[model samples]
Target chain A: MTDENIANHLKSLKKYTPARIGVGRTGTRPLTKDFLSFRTDHAAAVDAVYGEVSSKLIEELDLFSVETCYETKDHYLKRPDKGRILSEEAKTIIKEKCTPNPQVQIVVSDGLSASAIDENILDVYPALLDSLSMYGLNIGTPFFVKGGRVACMDDIGEILAPEAFILLIGERPGLVCAHSLSAYMCYQPKKGMKESDRMVISNIHRSGTPAIEAAAHMGTLISKMLDQKKSGVGLVI
Target chain B: MYKKTTLLGITYEFHSLKEIMAKANEEKSGDELAGISAENMKERMAARAVLAETTLSDIRSYPVVAPEKDDVSKLIEENVNEEIYGVIKNWTVADLREYILNDEHLSKELLQIGTGLTSEMIAAVTKIMSNLDLIQAASKITVITHCQTKIGQKGVLASRAQPNHPSDHLAGIRASLFEALSYGIGDAVIGINPVIDTTDNIYALLNETKEVIDRFDIPTQNCVLSHISSQMRAIEKGAPADMIFQSLAGTQTGNESFGISISMLEEATSLIFEKGTAEGQNRWYFETGQGSELSADAHFDVDQLTLESRCYGLAKHFNPFIVNTVVGFIGPEYLYDSKQVIRAGLEDHFMGKIHGLPMGVDVCYTNHMSADQNDMDNLSTLLSTAGVNFVIGVPMADDCMLNYQSLSFHDIATLRNVLGVSAAPEFADWLKKQGLTISSGQLTKQAGDPSFFL
Candidate 1:
């Protein structure tokens, strides 16, 4: 291809708008200060609500194995390669905190948006596990990833060899909501497995989707993946 | 209402609390007990008023500086002035917003700070109003970059001699991969050059990639390949390999280039599958075959491939194949109008059908507008509306360093909230729940936590 040819070829593709622009300025108003103050107050209120919910869930579910994992956003954002590898301490905790071997391994991560996990996991996780139990599958030791990515599944799969691996992680940060989460599942997940090798259940949140329904659906899909031995486009379901 | 009085107190020397209290008692206008309480309250109010006055004075000392576009040295100089005062009195917090909006130069400077107070507020507010849970769920998505090589027979050397270089094909691939990966999509299937030539060196390049495959342990079985020769050879054989492989390859590339022949690629895959079946081994198989040259009358017709055929062909080869196209650097003007190219390619190749694969647009970062939120949102929304899945480019240096290569969880949430779309939220939330974090300067873990989700 000539310079002209290459130039012409490039001339034909669509353009990309920055992700932030999709979220326009909130707007200017005489009550803008009041609105901002109110928002901050609401944030505090929500935090309190979620905190109470979390404690209740822990109590109601009889989950004595829960541990609080904390990390700074700065550390999580700078080291993606590090994100792919689990910390020794985390591994130790995982080994000690829950069952060792089971039919499947389920993990929850805060990913880039910790609020996502803090907000939705309490409801979604239990629903999913219940579905799994109904399918006669035993869940392995469940752990939390502080700053996770999709590739982290490979590391988790390598560390804990389960028949199926289900990872509920946060999505990339956007302008609108920071609490969304997705469940990615694969059979015998290993390093360098293309995304097509996995099945995803996405849009599981309160506003756009029902977390409970998504969990139940994810449960059904995982069972199907185990039975079919395929995912993505290959899985019949 | 009680009488109002203003008192100013300045001490030339420090006095003990007892002495101050005695003086306050001496000036009381009531009985001893009430006088003491009133004196204490007066002192307390006086202290608070003094502190507030000082703070206001300090803020007034420093002039508010506007943001710069290229050079931030001036803003820094002004910020230093503000710091010396221990408080910013003249500039209200609202002034910060004005500075960002009115002065592009200052905003660029602030971006250098990585995580400034303003950005943090923006990120936090954005996260709250947006439905982050949904963004995370849809995080794993596909981004396809569509392109078609200009019609002509040009050797690899000749193509390399041009400005884009090996970058032409690489650009398309990079854009598609970038878009897919940015959105947390793990796999990306790219379209091979439609006008395959005997002299092309891609085969050699693939051989080199073998090391990458082995080192990464990437499953090579899923990475399929198809060429004209492979298709033709499959057709000549009576085996069903020709139909399977030809159809698959055609479907994969049909969304990419109209010139791709799905039947040819499918035919080859079928032959290979049959060969594997005959051998009685469940081995990984990728079809290799050849295609008959088109007659003069049939040449144009042969070049046109349908979207359905392309999708089917790719589905046959790799179940969830990602179809991408190329958009070469035509010129600066083309930078602003890239959608025209994608529209034309879609019209020409798929006949305006939307494929399941993620579609994307790739361009040079040089042409990309710097630190323009409006531009970014416009571009993202346009692609999303057009059914484009992702965008690939050299994220702005500041953005990349800030680790904002793709949409941030906060940004994605904002998009969903504004557009009332669930996909963005689902995708973002899914990424976050996976514990995948994007920092400003690098892709790193958060503190002492493990990177993996186990």
Candidate 2:
């Protein structure tokens, strides 16, 4: 085949998949352009992990600030157990500021990618509020926990003891989408709950599941969890 | 068993055999996260020193997780060759390492002696081995298993075409698979990790890959890496599946976390043997990694390296057709960076090979880890030189579904060309027929064009 025919053939194949294909090679290795493009994508993902959620966004969302036991970015990355518990100061602050035992308690955190919250929360948060109100649910005071893990909801859950809990957190960044967010919900969340008891709606981003769509969907899931009095694998969606 | 050792005028003591084993391991963030890693460099060396003097009998008697509490330990214990064990039970762990590295011993003798050792013994020796020691010992053994075609033959490097689509789009999977075949990949298997785990989705993927195989008459098998239960249900409904796949863990509790058990595996094996399309005896595919046990909170105070070795022990019971360690996919906690991932890859490959399994390495990393494509390139080249049975091939080294990077189809083609290795013999013959590869195992100019199949 001629080079032109191969190019068209590659284009046709590339149309069907999102994978990096048909990038012409130089000998056995990838060409410089394709190589650098991949490197750039990787750099964005790494930056997302290291970046911090802006305090301005926290104030704009009308949320109080708290922290997990994670002391630094490196500590949070290495010691997941530490990230699962609230700091003593955070516990006291949460107790003073947040409502106790509401129908639904919502929390936000930077689980892995701060950019996920930076890019997505403005769209997801308002839609979630509107959806929860439409569902006629009593929403509790929402707060932000810096450097928190998915299970950190348990620590917050124990202090507040809500019937249902939702933790809007950043997902581990991938090359295709660095600013992806996830919503983890549990019914009667508490300390020492099984992972199977938590449900997640992941890949919420512009190109994947749109932030507003995922936010709207979470309200429905929370309603279902309340109706069934359970969550995770046992709850029918 | 010895529990205290003095090294460089510093004395160290361990509380138990498990602690000794944990501290002897190379530095891993997962072990440290569990609060079990050695405190300093001297302590690590001291633990290795104590471990080297421990005998095979000592390791066997003090199983990491006792046989009564864990079915994995029970299975491993029951499978030991008693006669061979009697012959080598008195050998020290250091003796075992030297025996493996000895030039006089060939693959057959090494494999025979491996039957006498348990997983703990394997982990013990692995901790004491250097990176080169791991590679040199693994390169000496060749484990060949067969399904629709053979894999792991000497001088034959294979690739598993992982044509995974983010949405399980049939056309997208086929397109990536075509790209892989153009580069003479997928001699091991055409496997896809479906986004949906329902039986219907697995059935459709199985049929799609089967159609591709039949249309081209490719000497390869097809698999959808769904849960084994889903695959079993698909096969029961008459899907054309060549092998069943599952992710294994070291402890029974860990397997439970994956929703699998030995009995369930046995049932799946029987169903495949009774209904599946594979023409060979070896028909199970398993993927394992370090830190899975700990991730499930089921490591039982054992180290990740030892838990990973026990996964091989479990895979050995089934005689899997292909077994690979997704070495770096677990993330930075288990293997912190390129350095740790590289060490774990070599260690996993060596341990799996010595257990007489068709071992492969999915030389890969996730975005959260401090690694890049260069690390993958280095590890893949090293593994190919180590005579790995196969490596995973994704389009352009990026997996949209799994959200990680692995070796690409071009990378496999380059490895085969550079190392003077060919694909499994039958697939190589088929590639020659398609004019994608020449007799010299170099890719032709017509290669890397999916339109060639069209």
Best by DockQ: 2
- Residue lDDT tens for model 2, B288-394: 99999999999988999999999999999998999999999998888889999999999999999999999999999998888899999999999999999999999
- What clash pairs does model 2 have? none
**Candidate 2 versus the native: TM-score?**
0.96
lDDT of 2: 0.92
Least accurate 10 contiguous residues by lDDT in model 2 chain B: B1-10
Kindly report which residue stretches of model 2 are placed more than 4 angstroms away from their true locations once superposed: A1-9, A135-138, A223-230, A233-237
What's the distance in Å from true for residue B399, model 1? Answer: 18
TM-score of the first chain alone, every candidate: 0.69, 0.97
Per-candidate TM vs. native?
0.32, 0.96
Global lDDT of each candidate = 0.36, 0.92
Model 1 TM-score? 0.32
Instruction: Give the per-residue lDDT of model 2 (tens digit) for A109-220.
Output: 9999999999999999999999999999999999999999999999999999999999999999999989999999999999999999999999998888997789888999
